[model samples]
Target: MGHGVVLAGLCAALLIIATLAMGCGAMPIRAEDVLGALLRWIGAHPAQGDDAIVLSLRLPRVLMAALAGAGLACSGAVMQGMFRNPLVEPGLIGVSAGSALGAISVIVLGGAASVGWLGSFGVTAAAFAGGLLTTALVYMLGRRRADIATLLLAGVAINAIAMAGIGVLTYMASERQLRDLSLWTLGSLGGTDWRRLLAAAPWIVLSLAWLPLHARALNALLLGEREAGLLGYRTRPLQRRLIALTALATGAAVASCGVIGFVGLLVPHAIRLAWGPDHRLLLPASALGGAILLIGADTVARTMVAPAELPIGILTALLGGPFFLWLLLRARDGGVRA
Candidate 1:
């Protein structure tokens, strides 16, 4: 418990450091100035400095990314435990694709930029609706048949269809729309402001608070439906709750951050390996671990090229893809991977 607390503290510190460091960018602001501004804003007695960059720019993006990372990782951990499949990512059951399709629909049909918060609003709603709808469809199609395999396969089919829709939208998009879509898809912590953060903060906080409660329940469910049922845990209700929570968190993330992948898949597994597979510890640890990793990656994305920025999502894939492949190979020995 002490170790968990210590590690959580370390993760939080690293997240802050990474956020501040990444915020420095090519913005021509000193770290001290940024820190002082932040302190002053937070009601601390800061000596002096303008909070222009901290308030107007960096703070929101960093916060948004951190929230998104934590949310996605939490969702992934829950999904894996619920499904008893480590390879199961937040999108494995078509949630991500559903979100993407919703965002695209808004982009193409609603003229995303014309309305103020409409872009985010429409996209977020679409994503949530899509995720739930897809899940319901998959569940309905597979449940009566008593086939988990078919359910997953249906998710795949739905994902492919959603991707096809996205492709068509992209193909028909104007140059500006294409550019907007590309950046959104690639993912960035670059252009966030307070309003976006306000939209995202609630869901992330709610998820952070709510998701961990399922730790014991998830552990029980992992032992199979009958075992879980015999232990006074209702399997179907638990599964529904897990799916809903996972979808809500992931949908909110996709709504805010676009489709940043692998944080969810990678973070929980790393925590499980280090701290043992206890969801009680794994859930919060994965949240902090994910935030740290993302903030760190975003820092590199900003500084590695200097004066120019890379998408944070690109950096995550570069780091996570190889690790995922290695995980796959190791799992071939019939151990828990992903």
Candidate 2:
């Protein structure tokens, strides 16, 4: 399919899915009602009752999911392109684990602020910081060897350390903190609101804006390091910038919504299969595809059991795990690299 057609399709799917998600949940507002509520709020009409519920509660979480999804998908796309490995993803570098550890630390030691907006912002900040720290550590370690294998090994080491830290924090947590940590680690959009959106959206947006600017660099890098150097791109500096931007995006995502997996790994691979591995189109398409997927998964997660909600991370993993195995089998059977 042409990039235009695919992008338009993704945009349409995102709209349809977002509208559908808006009408889902215990209240189950009609689609028309959801549209009307949106129009009414847009038109400066005072929202009350159902309108308030849709405008205030449903909308923010949906937007949060979209932003987080887009960030992760973009991060994954770039990671795969830079590493020249379809299996590579942002979390491979320990951003998610580091973010989780940071948030867990705050939850266990910081008291009941997780329930408040200010405290929520603190957790987001700490998570962002932790993610950056870990990514930087991995990047520096990898830079010493200056090869993809070294970088990946560095990432593995960092991932293990972050996870171990998370485990220690989890073990030390009080019951309430433990419960909170469990939910956060598992991931959800359930706690999002306007304020939380304010806290997390900018980092995702910044990453979204920043990563695509390097599309040409990524395309060059994928042509092999020697070729890219012959083309005048300083590969080491390019890698540094990519890692930094990816950490920002992935950190914000993990911080805001906890450790939602697979969107990063899954969306880019799917995009590559559907549209070919052109980073220019791959970057934006992955963003839209990611939004569609997470919104759809989140809708299923929230409405699956009505009064009770499933963690979206679980849903994505459940879906991505089987798909990953199939991918592995395909590779083993001599399938082409994306």
For each of the candidates, the C-alpha root-mean-square deviation to the true structure, in angstroms, is 3.0, 2.5
Candidate 1 versus the native: TM-score? 0.88
TM-score for each of the candidates: 0.88, 0.91
Candidate that would win on TM-score = 2
Per-residue lDDT tens digits for candidate 2, residues 5-80, read 8889889989999999999988889889999999989999877558988988999989999999999999889888
Q: Model 1 residue 169 lDDT?
A: 88
Please give, for residues 1-338, the per-residue lDDT of candidate 1 as tens digits.
Answer: 56567576857686567546635677656666777777787895644655766777777777777788888888878877876667666655677778777777787777774466656677667777776677666555644553345545776898899889889989888887786676547777766778767766776788788889989998997787799999999888877877777777777777677777788888988887777878888888888777777777777888889888888788888877897787667767656432
